[model samples]
Target: MRVALELVKEGRAEACVSAGNTGALMGLAKLLLKPLEGIERPALVTVLPHQHKGKTVVLDLGANVDCDSTMLVQFAVMGAVLAEEVVGDQKSPGGVAQYRGRRNQRPRQYS
Candidate 1:
């Protein structure tokens, strides 16, 4: 855990993944890197298989035991953002004309 945190601190690693001890990892992360702005506490986040053949984002698996409504909402928003920006397919489907042309084609600008 210390080594992972050190790598992150030294810019050698972008992020750290650990399954050793949730409490210890959270404590070390909080003490070393600090929380992001507007985030009171960090929530555990993971991607899980969904029933609809898709993926679902689950949060606060164990990191936070008691979360208020606000915290839950925040987690929801964070999960959504992560899914959209990191996991979701950004390109349009094959049938969509908007994405059928040149790969570098930009979206049409509205006057």
Candidate 2:
């Protein structure tokens, strides 16, 4: 995991994908790559196809399971930017961003 992250950091690779332990990957990434400035914790985000249409972005799947409001907002902003850039073109309409914390908790959504 460290080598994979190092490749990206050194510009040898664009990104790293892992099918190993989530905790291990996140731990190594945080230690090796470090979080961006002002980011309390780095999040793991995935893009999934929505049931109806378009794509849905889910974050912190295993990293930072208990995030604060500020962290949630940060994840939302990052997810929105990723969805817009990777899932759609600039002309596409922006979609909503939502954050659900813990099981059984109500979801907080934004446009």
Candidate 3:
């Protein structure tokens, strides 16, 4: 994990993905990559299968225990960017859309 982070720090890699120890990965990533400007915390986001046979992006599963509205907004923006850039049209098929989850309510989609 350290070596993978080092490669990212050295600009040899665009991103790093790991399935091991979420907390450790988050800590190491924060330490090595640093947060993007205006992004106070880096979110741990992943694409998951939705009931509609589509993919949904979820973030900060364990990286953050509690988040404020601002943090949530930041995560949403980051998720949207990831969906557009990383996931791409080939994977999405329906085009990139941002889905914001509300308390006790279904996710609201925005183009």
**For residues 25-105, what per-residue lDDT tens digits would candidate 3 score against the true structure?**
888887888665678878777788789766777666657765667887777667767777776624542222243344445
Clashing pairs in 3: none
Which lDDT value does model 1 have at 77?
Answer: 62
Candidate 2, residue 60: the lDDT equals 69
Off by over 4 Å in 3: 49-54, 89-111
List the global CA lDDT of all models: 0.67, 0.72, 0.71
TM-score attained by model 2: 0.67
Cα shift from native, residue 27, model 1 (Å): 1.5
Q: Which candidate is the best by lDDT?
A: 2
Q: Model 1 over residues 1-111: C-alpha lDDT tens digits?
A: 979987897889978899689888888877787655666777677777878757766666667755565776676666666677766933312111132223345456669
lDDT of 1 at 18: 91
Order by lDDT, highest first: 2, 3, 1
Q: Write the number of the candidate with greater lDDT, choosing between 1 and 2.
A: 2
Model 2: per-residue lDDT, tens digit, 1-111? 888999988889978899888888887877888565667667887778889877777766767766677887777666666777777734434333464557667555659
Whose TM-score is greatest here? 2
All candidates: CA RMSD in angstroms? 15.2, 5.2, 7.1
Per-residue lDDT value at 7 in model 1: 89
- In candidate 1, where is summed lDDT lowest over 10 consecutive residues? 92-101
Q: Assess every candidate by TM-score.
A: 0.62, 0.67, 0.64
